[model samples]
Target: MHAGFTLVEVAVVAGILGLLALTMTSAFEGMEQARQQNTAQAHAEAARQALRTFMLRNKRLPCPDNSTYGDRGREANGAGSCPGDLRVGWLPYESLGLQVPVRSQRLRYGVHRGTNADLVAPLHGAVDGPDLEGTGGLARALATAAQAAPSTDQPHYSGAVPALSSDTCASAEPVNPAFVLAAPATDRDVDGAIHPGFDGPNRGFATSSPCVAPPARPATRIYDDVVVAESATTLLGWLSTATR
Candidate 1:
């Protein structure tokens, strides 16, 4: 008998080798994805902690439900509104001395608000009625100054509020919900406007009918991968206080 390996034996060996290679490849991919998810979660927790600290100091939450007083748009007289600026990236966190990591992608921050018009004005203070009581000292000051000079015609500072239907927090008109943190998935329905960081014009994120887009490609922002699931998409702070 010829001392040669049979064809069947060779085929079996080849099949086993292929299976081993596939298993290794899958394991590597899974590990990478897990690592990414962990990193994103860590960032999220950091953001939350920063906001909590801000609340402790300010006697109110960093991103108030119905106000944009401390949002990125008004940061450091607009110095922190740049895309790479740590102030805008982390919102109120930056002021607390936290340094956001410089990842391949940027993060977006958002605020949580209710549908109450009186509480939160729509369109960055557009509907902010007269501060008759002068509750909002800043708004009152702006109103006083604007009235002093008729030629100035400067718009009064309005409170930040959502302009969406009561049924859905999504805005029927173009309005920017203050971002508290960056999201992971781009395809998710984003209710807020684009940050001045992302918007070339002064306006924040623009509006789209569907309000959902494809998964932000790798080059987008790091947090673009972190999506807010529809069921749990309500503002975290709001959820904490809900009766349910």
Candidate 2:
């Protein structure tokens, strides 16, 4: 008869198999995360291009899709004369004719809300006058003035993936950004709830700054929010090029 394997050999084999399984699970998780990151970046770029196309055709920026005031995926009345306070909200996919796979992946949008150069309102009248630059001029001026602006230091936690403390402050603000697009990251804590600071200052109209840092931690905050910004100069340049 063939000799049977000892209990020690069986235990050793079982442990080795368990370790291999664990390693494979980790590798798969990492690959999925990379895929998600790439998809989010592509979606953000698409949204940016769509905004440019919309502006080139309409001569005005669309207001964000404010679910509180109207239906989802559509721009609010603000596009015509968006209230000065209504500056940041969900991307108006319907207004821009932009599409994405699901609502969860929709970008958060923020337009330049300077009183001197409100960008969300219709610019038809401005373009009708002798000086073809109306809101465009104001935006240009803001962009120029912001060239030497100082960075904003806000109180927040430390670390890149998870905050270890709460007494630190960094130059965390984007000065005079003409527009910003942000995509929320996956739940790093895996607690089924998104941490408040994960998206940094890109949360809401009140909390959303012109821009924010990514993968930053702010006091136990799990963060990896992807963000993109367009300067007024760049936008006006594009508009000029597109119209010419």
Candidate 3:
């Protein structure tokens, strides 16, 4: 009869197999994470381009998709206007004519929805074409509010306190938020727990909303959402070059 393997040899073989399994698992997990990140980036980029195109064509930005007013992706009021109180909501993908499904549309969008400076206000509504004043009033309004002191008029997206009127904390401040698009990361570390970076003040009403800057705070914070903002400066600059 042939001699069989020793006990230690069996144990060593088992340990090696275990290590191999662990390595394979880790590799798969890493691949999944990368895939999720890539998909999130692609979605954000596509949505950003769509928002810009819509603004260019309509001369006004479409409101976020508030659910009560219409379908899952349509504007709250069917292209008329967003509810004054609903500052943050889902991106109006359908309203923007986007093909993203309701189930896959996880992007949260927020805009400066002030009546005085409504970014959703139809600048082209006037028969004269663009705003009635014929001045760059629409774009100017957003710029003014974004630069003003922290208040209902200003846009915010993150946990940091809004900067003082004169203070310049470029890194901590939320300066470029004419509108913001936030996508929650797929890897929820806590599994079903609400993440502040994904559901916190940044996605709330104007009075309570915090300034938005992505990879949000708490040094150990996991699953930080991806956020992209469109600033008034950029919008105005684009408008300046448009064929209006």
* Top model number, lDDT: 3
- Going through the candidates in order, what is the number of backbone clashes in each? 24, 1, 7
Instruction: Name the better of 1 and 3 by TM-score.
Output: 3
lDDT of 2 at 46: 88
Top candidate when judged by TM-score against the true structure:
3
Per-prediction TM-score, please?
A: 0.43, 0.72, 0.73
User: Model 2, 1-244: lDDT tens per residue?
Assistant: 7599889999999999999999999899777666666776787788889888777666666787756322377777645656667667778888888653465566777776554455665332333455354445544443443353433321111123423332222344435556667765554444332323234344432143333443233322343456666767788777666656
Evaluated against the true structure, the overall lDDT of model 1 is 0.34
Q: lDDT per residue, candidate 1, 26-105, as tens digits?
A: 89866665666556656656666665545333322332211132333223333222222121222434554566344222
> Ranking under TM-score, best-scoring first?
3, 2, 1
Report, for every candidate in turn, its global Cα lDDT versus the true structure.
0.34, 0.57, 0.60
TM-score of 1: 0.43
Worst 10 contiguous positions by lDDT, candidate 2? 150-159
lDDT of 2 at 6: 89
Lowest lDDT 10-residue stretch of candidate 3:
162-171
Go through the candidates in order and give the C-alpha RMSD of each one to the true structure. 12.6, 5.4, 6.2
